[model samples]
Target: MDPVNLLFLVPAALLAGFVDAVAGGGGLVTVPALLATGIPPAQALATNKLQGSFGTLMSTWTFWKAGQIDIRSMLFPVVCVLVGAAAGTVAVQVIDASLISAVIPFLLVAIALYFLLSPRAGDLEAQARVSLPVFGLTVGIAVGFYDGFFGPGTGSFFAIGCVALLGMPMRKATANTKLLNFTSNVVSLAVFALGGQIIWWVGLAMAVGQVTGSFIGSHAALRFGAKLVRPLLVVVCLAMTVRLVANPQHPVYGWVSGLFSG
Candidate 1:
């Protein structure tokens, strides 16, 4: 990338890191920036994973240092995330992404609405509805697989699962989400790297920004609690849903366009 083009990405990556650390939606920013810079979709996805891994790592470290996450307790979930993400990454290389692309927007919309309407969704901690082993096997594997394959809204999904099933407060859920996000990201990054799909120069450049932004964002979450994080989560998910559906190649977009033309 040229100096000017590279400069354009730095601020976007920085902002993405911050937003992602808080409520998960950084790809809503960074992926578009990559595509705008003319990176092909596969390379863009791979490169985004590279920078995202850095941001998630920083966020996870910050949350851990603050005593928000229990790494030892999360080992099983982390292992599930690794296995699921590896499967997803490998599947994506062979499968037609359109298979799931059509459905994710609706799922994102549902998640946004759930948080929007539920007053207690993330505000207060409650009793866990299911055992940790069950949560790990189900939500962990499903969301981790989605993260590796489709690469958007993974954080929000994990956050909701933590809140609804694990009964963690918003802040704690966000913290734990980062840990899982980091795990899936690292696993996916390895797969992408092995396939030689990453744009190293661009990814590394963005990663520098991700580290700094995530640090600030994580601290912000620790300070503000649900008041700040909740709204951001809704906005990010809705925004990502719109971004995906607005693409003319997207099924929803195509359907809408066809209706209008007809």
Candidate 2:
């Protein structure tokens, strides 16, 4: 990449990391930036994952150090996410993603509304609605698969699941989300790397920005707790929903196209 184009990615990656650390729609920014650089779609996706892995890892470390994530307790969910992501990566090649893509925007709207309308949401931990095993199988594995397959709003989905199903506070939810996000990101990044899809120099430059921004964002989340995370999660999810729904390849967009054509 040229110096100008490469330089443009730094700030974009930084902003993405900051948003991702808080609410998880970082790819909503970085992936578009990579595509704007005129890389092929596959390379753009691969490079975005490469940079995203760094930001997620930084956020996970920051959360872990803050005593938010208990690795021992989370081990099962972590493994579930890893396995789910790997499966999703393979499945995407065979399955049509339109069904899931069509549903995600509506799901995001519901999640956003639940957070917005529920006064007690993300405020404090309540009794979990599901056991750890069930949560791991349903939310953890499902979201992990979604991350590897479609991936626009994986963080927001995880955060919502943590708050609503797992009954965790926003801060802890954000911390745990990072762990799962990092796991899925690493899984996808490795596959992309093996496929020779990543643009290494570009990925590395953006990764530096991602790490720095993620560090700052994670600390901010720890300091501000629910106050910062809740609103940001809503915004990021809605934004991702809009992005996906507007995509020409998305099923919803295809419906829109048919409407206009008719």
Candidate 3:
């Protein structure tokens, strides 16, 4: 809550919003910045959701106005995400998150590789591999729960799901990702609010930055389409993977250290 911290966090949120709007790794920036301010981890995560909601809302609105998202078709997925996020948020209060922390770096690496190697990952809409209902039940619930529980690369998860499973173009995938992400974020934010974990002033101040950044980022995505989104998605996932493993306490670091010592 120091004015000094605000000066740092608000700008971080702005940068986060820009990256998140385009490819969905905003938390990679904002969460660490929040933590660095010496807040409790729970409060930092809660405050993150509060600021992130503004960014997602702004990007979602931008995409909607641009005719990129179809809200009515997304209703079921939204409901599924809401349910999953609510459950995950509650579970996180009691569960140890170390396991997830250990596993996510590998998963992010895989995602980055998929984006990097896939010839047609986000180029165009193809035939859906699964029905909408199936996507809602599977990706919606799973990624929503992940967002509520751990929440770093949620936008990437949603965007990839929309592209690979639902067969959406990159721009449309990014648009819908924001909407579904907003759903999970709001559900998690509400639970955090109920637990009295959020710092309103900090969250609100960062939100101003988030809104401005999201507006610009969403427009850039619209302008450049796949060329912008695909590379950013790969970079964000890779960056998140590195950030996660860089933590000395992260299980991957320990595992690698043991391997080298052995």
Lowest-sum lDDT 10-residue window in model 2: 245-254
Residues 192-239, model 3: lDDT tens digits: 899899999999999999999999999999999999999999999999
**lDDT ranking from best to worst?**
1, 3, 2
Candidates 2 and 3 compared by lDDT, better number: 3
Tens-digit lDDT track of model 2 for 194-257:
9999999899999999998899899999999888888888888788888987888788888888
Full-model lDDT, candidate 2 = 0.90
| Model 1 TM-score (2 dp) | 0.96
Off by over 4 Å in 1: none
Ten contiguous residues with the weakest lDDT in model 1: 1-10
Colliding residue pairs in candidate 2: none
